[model samples]
Target: MNVMKRIAQSALKKTLIVAMATGAMFSTQAFAAEKVYRLKLAETWGANFPIFGDATKNMAKMANEMSNGRLEIRIDSANKHKAPLGVFDMVKSGQYDMGHSGSYYWKGKVPNTLYFTSMPFGMLPAEQYAWFYYGGGMDLMNQVYSPHNLLSFPGGNTEFQMGGWFQKEINSVDDLKGLKMRIPGFAGEIMAELGAKPTNIAPGELYTALERRTIDALEWVGPSLDLRMGFHKIAPYYYTGWHEPGSELQFLVNKQVWEKLPADLQEILRISMKTAAYDMYIQAVHESGKNWASIKTEYPNVKVKDFPPEVMDALRAANDKLLKEHASQDPLAKEIQASQAAYLKEVRAWTDISTKAYLDNEAK
Candidate 1:
């Protein structure tokens, strides 16, 4: 399939492209009347990181093309910004007009921010997206970020992430004890409960950290982006995912900067971001299937394992306890958690009956 042709044929692309052509009819006069707006974005990933970085590029390209040169978005990766995890703070302080990062990165600063990203045993992308757009998840998210001078939107989805590449097989919960891993967000907290040492490592440094024994095991997404990182050489055991069912990335806009945009430009930017987010999810599915196939054919030493039932139960219990503790301390956290649980229960019923049932039947 021709990617450009497919995009141009999309409903969104057709609308915006027609609008651009229509505006051209009034070009002579409108050219002088239209003011160009330029914005700078800071992303958490280093330069040219796959999937994550591609989302930013796609968003920028769509915005520029849709707005007909009125809106220009320039991205600065971690190397340029020199602070991968500081995207939220920089965007909030107006140092950058926008940012591409994960919302869960800010949980330490704003406890409620954690819920915006994927949750352990939470709703998948489509369901969580339903919660965001239709089920008031977006409103709740703004309630968390608005006070901080930011507007957060879904940047992209990495789909379901693999558990992690481990140095040893996890036959039981005891196997996790004293294990040093480079996992992050609330998932790291849960690991800490199980006597494992969990730390956050920047993407550029993940390979070196794991190789040099700075961290024993790490989960840096699944095969879509992971195969390129060469983790299989260091850790032979690949575990299936239980945490971060659908890892959603985030795009942050400075509230003041957003309000300054013309209504048409704002709508264009919003649609561009939304389109890119879903595109990333689809792209991940394709990349993962291709890369995992390569791994099976080319890498015989790599081992795949799911956490044993006993270990899974322990993680679930810890997740519940931590969530309760967080909810009790913050009313907003409680509301968000309740909203997710309710939405998950509502959506997962259909998911099981439809998608799950289809897949299981096809397998048989």
Candidate 2:
């Protein structure tokens, strides 16, 4: 009987060992099944483009570190993709899993997109950020992007854009007549309304265009980005901005690809993008101050001017007319415009009191 009991005990031990080994194998398989997801991102900037490219790189790095190898993102700049303006279409069709480009660039393809970027005389950066996060801008953005099978997020801010680098000063509204400028989006429409010939040129070709008088003026970001373009050397007049008060770049994600990410990884990506966007804004501010100081010190010949009161009035009138035309055509456009107008009114008051007031007081 004792011998029988020993044999039974041995059989039980072997059964338990088999069960434990099988469980371990299944656990390993489960872990393996959650393999690293690789995604491709296309950007609208050339390779090694300064602040814009850095934003994407930083986002990818953060995502990778947070996911602990579960997610990987590869970025292809305009140099690699050779489709700077086609980022929207490529991401929509899933040819690229993500994209970094200006949302306003899609105005021709998606009219509502214009509202999400900076409008002519729009809210400043802080106010716009508040509107985006707290004032229903994100929901409106999602509504606009959802039909395209893409998700949109604020990629970064260019702070307050410098008006443009001009060969001649804009002294009056008459000076805008027949002026050839390379500007894009709604601002270009506003320029055209004011009788300026607005053209769109690739960033890589902007300097050559300006130098050769192919375009008389161009607005590229601010000192943060424009300094590197060497525009200060060719275009002697630097105008203060009235358009694109706070330009925001966008991140485009293929909805299908975004959906495929695990819950944890999705959170990681969202946080990564948000953090990177904020970081880019801060970096841009730092670079702008540094580069503007350099430009003033090194290129003292560059004249800084603001649009005259008459020119400002004409531009504002044109902007109002065009916005009205847009609103009249599409209900969604009207809704967005109304939202922006309301938000801007509410926020600009505080900005005037808080920011403008301080500056005015300090200057005095």
Question: Which candidate comes out best when scored by lDDT?
Answer: 1
lDDT of 2 by residue, 1-364 (tens): 2456547656755765687777743344444434679999999999999999999999999998777656789999998999999999999999999999999898889989988879898888888989999999999999999999999999999888999999998888889899999998899999999889998777888999999999889999889999899998898899999898888899999999999887888899999998888899899999999999998899888888989999999999999999999999999999999999999999999889998999999999
The per-prediction tally of clashing pairs is: 0, 0
lDDT of 1 by residue, 1-364 (tens): 2466446446544565587888744344343325679999999999999999999999999998887677899999999999999999999999999999999888889988999889998988899889999999999999999999999999899988999999888888888999999988899999999999999878999999999998889998998988999999999899999998998999999999999998889999999999999999999989999999998999978998889999999999999999999999999999999999999999999999999999999999
| Candidate 2, residue 67: how far the Cα is off, in Å | 0.9
* CA lDDT of each prediction against the hidden true structure: 0.91, 0.90
Candidate 1: what lDDT?
Answer: 0.91
Q: Pick the candidate with the highest TM-score.
A: 2
> Which segments of model 2 are wrong by more than 4 Å?
1-29, 32-34
TM-score of candidate 1 against the unseen true structure: 0.91
Each prediction's TM-score versus the true structure: 0.91, 0.92
After superposition, candidate 1 runs with Cα above 4 Å error: 1-33
